[model samples]
Target chain A: MAKEVRLWEGNHLVAEAAILAGCRFFAGYPITPSSEIAEYMAVRLPQVGGTFIQMEDEIASMGAIIGASLAGVKSMTATSGPGFSLKQENLGYACMAEIPVVVVDVMRGGPSTGLPTHPSQMDVMQARWGTHGDHWIIALAPAFIHEIFWATVRAFNLSEKLRIPVILLLDEILAHMHEGFRLPDSSEIEIVDRAKPTVPPDRYFPYDESQGDVPPLAAFFSGYRFNITGLNHDKSGFPTTNPEIIQRDMERQRRKIERHLDEILWWDEHELEGAELAVIAYGSIGRSAHAAVDRARALGIRAGLFRPITLWPFPEKRVAALAEQVRTILVPEMNMGQLVLEVERVAAGRCDVVPLGKVGGIPIDPPEILEAIKARV
Target chain B: MAFDYEKYLRMERMPHMWCPGCGIGIVVKAMLRAIEKMGWSQDDVAVVSGIGCTSRTPGYLDFNTLHTTHGRALAFATGLKLARPDKHVIVISGDGDAAAIGGNHFLHACRRNIDITLIVVNNYIYGMTGGQASPTTPFGMRASTAPYGAVDPAMDICQVAIAAGATYVARGTVAQGLLLERYILNGLKHKGFSVIEAMSDCPVQYGRRNRMSSAVEMIQWIRDHGVPVTRAKELPPEELEGKFVTGELHVAERPEYTEEYRRLIEKAQKAAEGAHG
Candidate 1:
């Protein structure tokens, strides 16, 4: 039986859910929209035998999470625009080193601190490619408070399962807004622990591909002595400058995520049985788009909504398949047409791609989306 | 008869990468002595290091160790400590790695006051990358980049750590071998963020660039000029001016970052469980 949940702000729910998930280490600096996460962790982490640190800055916060993760703890950090920018370098290192960590970016208006307290979906590209080099990134965006809790849990599970960093992309509205969330009973959720090598210490190779794709992690002081590095490394994890080794290693790192695409991609479709116009969006904006699509349908328009939960390893095939059914696709984002370009590329001239975007942190009003959808219809 | 320190040493690997009579060797010995005194199971301690000549400390030791990227040892060690707070995490880094590129992390680690011991070997210049002036390079020190001499003054690491909220802050020199051992041990025992800045000699790069030619001469200079904070207090300001004050500068107690966080989690859990029950 589903019980009525009292209204809870998205940020509070995320913080509460983090505590429930057995997250014991949170190192972050305060920033707008995301400040509530740090504040909640600061007050809540200690009550549950967890550690909360407001680092000197975002770089240190990132470093601390990596440190905490290595110590065999589930660790996370929260940040916004500029702080996210400061974290890219270490984020790349975490990916290359195969460290399991969760980084929450409650994105704000930016280029450089453009709108500290406002919302923007401008970080989509940065979250994917801001870090140097080629590496797989798992990013999830939640549309509501309950989703924040579930998404954070998913972030941790994916991070440990893939042995890579997972990013939870929240916007200002969702991170700061209020919504009731039902806390899951402990038995309801499945938690995944990092894989420990079953091989004896003497025979263990840190990065040995013998496991097929995902290698087991040997915790420090485990008597399994094996090298770990950020450099392009062989299965033994020692530095290798060989081009073939570098190429193979990079592909393997990417393939580990790409090969599991079936389990990674997620989306929701609304009223698209025979739609001629499709509206695509994500994060908080997706919620608004859903309402706008409903309003359009009441006015005799064949407008539909498609919302993606997994932003990267993008559901290109799904979008392309949908494009074949629709004559036009409208993408509404909080940025200057970032996701729209992606939709256009995937649509591949089969459909008209229209971008409805706003800068300076103001969310695209539902009416603006409705009008766009109505015009397309 | 000196317990045959050489037996434990990696002899074949010698013709050490460090210059002749460098103080790093003395500091490493002191560290080893402290580790021995603690009687920690070697398997339970991980000596992590970042890129620098001092970073080589992990490679020569038999314990589980990690040699990480430049200026990121603390970051890596933080992960190691959080993952297993039961294990001893000792981070050995140079002035450049700890104070320059890693300055932000250094300050926050002090502020967080987690249970970790950081030994910063301050040679006052970027030795491994060539004699570039570092955040700790004294004013007017010549370096590859500062050919005209550095106009910016060096940062006092002990003062910075104290200001940044470290529970334990101390300064020692490799020249004072016994004192250095005591300081390292004290830092290890502090139970929170502890920083021991061992003023070391980089005779090869820093000394050559700044005109202090030999490592022995550098050690002798530190021994003659380094002033104890207690004794220096009696001396006039002008007399203590320009001299490096060496000793345990500060110690205090506060709820560490991890402990405080743990408390919050327990409280939240109790409230939730109570309400549900």
Candidate 2:
């Protein structure tokens, strides 16, 4: 079979990549920028023997994906700002219950419904802290069409492997933009299925930590008569009010994610051979930062780019290490200053963290990023 | 094999959080009996629930169960059913959880005609929240929120389910355990969306506050006014003024949601092949 070179929109590529990655279920409500993902899925999923539902609302869409995940399917949903906010409650439910799901939030500026068809990376902090309670969230942002497709696949792979939800963040520029896409050969790309229980059906405990901190999940109707609950439970999966058990559940949720940071976090670091300045950025903003770094280098300034592919574990150690190597680290974002606060907090006194925030539904350009680097240098 | 309630229930989770004399237990027992009678293994069943006293039913069931957040069980069950069409998905929810907060999901699930058995324990009040007025709370029934008495008329959940396109819709009182059990059995057997509204008594919440003094009085009220569909057909409309008919009130044949989607997949796959050609 010969591979086809296809022209693909960012959203279409995400849908194609997701199907290739074995996303058999998708439920979402239409919202701008994100609607293309839903539209593509609605037509494409059925052809691949997958289910696509335009739910009554975003809330149900979130709920449906969580349910499908619990039933042992690779499930996902796409939405924008308002829909993302609507999904927060069930996203928290997916976290507490340890259901593996993928949520794609195509950035459109907002505190409310800001700019529907324009790009903004305002959800950086919200992506991590949006859900209530203590939760380990893995979010991936892509700057271009190819990256969005890969991010969608990685989101599914990481979700199944980690037994937690993954958010694939894309700005409107990345989601709706059309580009020549080399159709990824499904067989060439690695895919991961969720781990199944090794124990006998009768002996199964849905939340059994004895198997591992991240317990193996048995599909709902796979003859494993286990239980799942949002409430904190013991090994038997019944709701436990026991304080020790509650503490254990909370600790395990936090510790499992923290321990696996090395496995989850992916970052980009450019030339920094005795460079005095570092520019840390993410999403589409990082694209500009990359170009700016190149421009700065041409201008005889020593600067490097550190782009974090994984947002939640926040690449703390990497940022901290980078901090020690530089006098100042400039953090630029499409938001007022969401990711910078995290960068600043981690950098500590090792460096002066400067923030270059951009809003009004527009992405910062290379010149803008170069200005930030020049001023800081 | 004889039906064994103990085999299906997790006794350790017992002394279930339901109040004394509450009818939620009866509904759970009836559902268990239905499962037992159907000869389905606990392994093949996924019992899901939203938050409330009735939602807690899945916690005690020795099945693949999920106790989810308030009122989203149908939406959750929709996904579960679609993912593994081989598994039977059953949802247990409360009056408020099903008809109030979760009503939109319920409507959509029915509209989809998804293969899910939703059995709502309509207790007329929010028992878990301490007797607040619920969607099914009768007009003039005093509740914690309606101290002076509920001024709004109650919403009939059966009509809502039918209107939402549920293939099977039925209402049964908890007092009539045998009959409710039969309807539940039929619901479990139904291939499309099925809704079994088990109108139950909340002795601690709605009963104590209202004129009903004991669980018996509440049970008696249903026993007296609850007319069977067969009998209601014989009686004049004026003669059955306040009586609500029980027994399988509605049954229709529709293409089940997941199965329809499966056909859609075949057609879409053929279309894609043609496009490739």
Candidate 3:
């Protein structure tokens, strides 16, 4: 087959990639800047022998995906700000239970439904620490339509690999914008699936620690009948109050994603060879940051771009390395210093971390980031 | 021979987390007995529950059980049933969890008519949270939060399930153990949405605030008010006033959600292949 360049919207590409990545179940409630993903899946999933449920609400949507994923299907749900808030409880449940599923939050302005149709990267911290309790999640964001497709595919792979919920965070710009990109064939994509139990049905434990940090997931209806609960549990999947077991499981949940950060995290750097200053951003802001870096280099100032696709793990080590090479690091986001705080925490005393945050539903243009770059240089 | 509950129960998680003389254990045993009677494999069944005194029942069961968030058991079960139609999914939830916080899910699950059995343990008071007035708390009944007496009218759960289009709706009191087991078994056998509203007792949280203070007193109260649907037909309207009717309330025939979705997939795939051809 010849390579086909298709004009695709970011949300549409997400649904397309999800289908290719073996996501057979999607339960979602529509929210602005992300509804197309669900709408597309509604028509597409059934044709592909998948299930799509428009749940009663965001909470139900999140709950449904967790349920479907447990039944040995790759499932997902998409939402925006307010809906995202409603999903936090079950999102935490997925974390504690280690159910592999994908969640997409197309970012819109909010503390509560602030901007429904406009762009904002405000969910950076919400994606990291949205749900209550101590847990780890892999959150990936994309700057354009092309990466949105690849990011969603990677999100499923990482979610399945680590047996955790991975968040694909996109803002209004990347979520709604139409762009041209070469459609990748599913056969060429490296897709990862959840491992099934190697033990017999009698010995199969849902949270088997002996298997590895990320235990093999036993299909719910499979003869390996095991329990799954939000409460801290032993390897048997029965809720436990034992102190050592609790600590061990909590640490296991954290290490499953944290220790495998090399396998879980992804970022791209541009023109950082002896650059005196760097621009750090993600999602749509990274798009502008990349353009700004090029403009800075054209003006004889060394400016590098460090855009993180994996947002939750925060790419701290790479950020610190960039901080050392650059005298000042410019961190621009839609939210007021959410990721910049992490950047500062990691790069503490290594360099100056300047934040360029814009609220009230507007994208930070390249010139503003370039000005930050020029001033720092 | 004595039935081996240990065959189906996760005995290690015991002593099970339920109050003394709580009705949840009876309901759990009835469900297990029903499953045992049906001879379904533990692997072929998935019991899901919400957060409540009743929702904790699944943790003690040997099936592929899930203890989910409050009031969302049905929604979760809906997804599970849809994805794996081969498994018989069942939801066990409390009154407050099912009708109050999870009320929307309860009604919609009925409307969708998916193949799942929902056994709602309607204990008038919120027993897990120290006797807050629940949606099923009869008017004028006292609870910890309803010290002045509950003002909200108690919801007729079976009526709502029937109105929402559940294919099978039945009523059973936890006090009527064998009868409740029969209703649960019949519910599991139903093809579409099946709901068994098992009126439960929360002696400590509810009974103490009202007239019935002890387990015996509460069980006696449940039995006294419980009217068999067959017997209620013979009683006068005034005599039957406020008396909850037990046994099967409604049964209907409808296409289940999962089967309908499968048909949709087959049709969709045919159309897609035709279009490609």
Candidate 1 residues B149-243, lDDT tens each? Answer: 89988899999999999999999998989999999999988889999999988888778876678887888877876899999888998997668
- Over B96-198, each residue of candidate 3 has an lDDT whose tens digit, in order, gives 9999999999999999999999999988978988899999998888988888988889899999999999999999998988899999999999999999999
Q: Write the per-residue lDDT of candidate 2 for residues A82-139, one digit (tens) a residue.
A: 8999999899999988899999999888989889888988888889999887788899
lDDT, candidates in the order shown: 0.83, 0.88, 0.90
lDDT at residue A218 of model 1 (Cα atoms): 76
Candidate 1 local lDDT, A1-377, one digit each (tens): 23457777777777777666768788898888888888988777766667777777787788778877766688889999899998897898888988888998998998897889889998999888879988889899888787888888888888888898988999999988887667787788878889998999767766777776778887778776555666677776666789987887788888888888887787888988888999999999999999999999899899899999889878999999989999999999999888788888999999899999888778887899998887766
For model 3, how does the per-residue alpha-carbon lDDT over A222-263 read when each residue is reduced to its tens digit? 778788989999998888889999998888888887789898
Span of ten consecutive residues with least summed lDDT in model 1 chain A: A1-10
True contacts kept of each: 0.60, 0.92, 0.86
Q: Clashing residue pairs in candidate 2, if any?
A: none
CAPRI quality band, candidate 3: high
* CA lDDT, candidate 1, residue A85: 98
Candidate 1 chain B weakest ten by summed lDDT: B3-12
Error (Å) of candidate 1 at residue A129 is 1.5
Model 1 native-contact share: 0.60
Count clashes in each candidate, considering only residues at least 3 apart in sequence or on different chains. 28, 0, 0
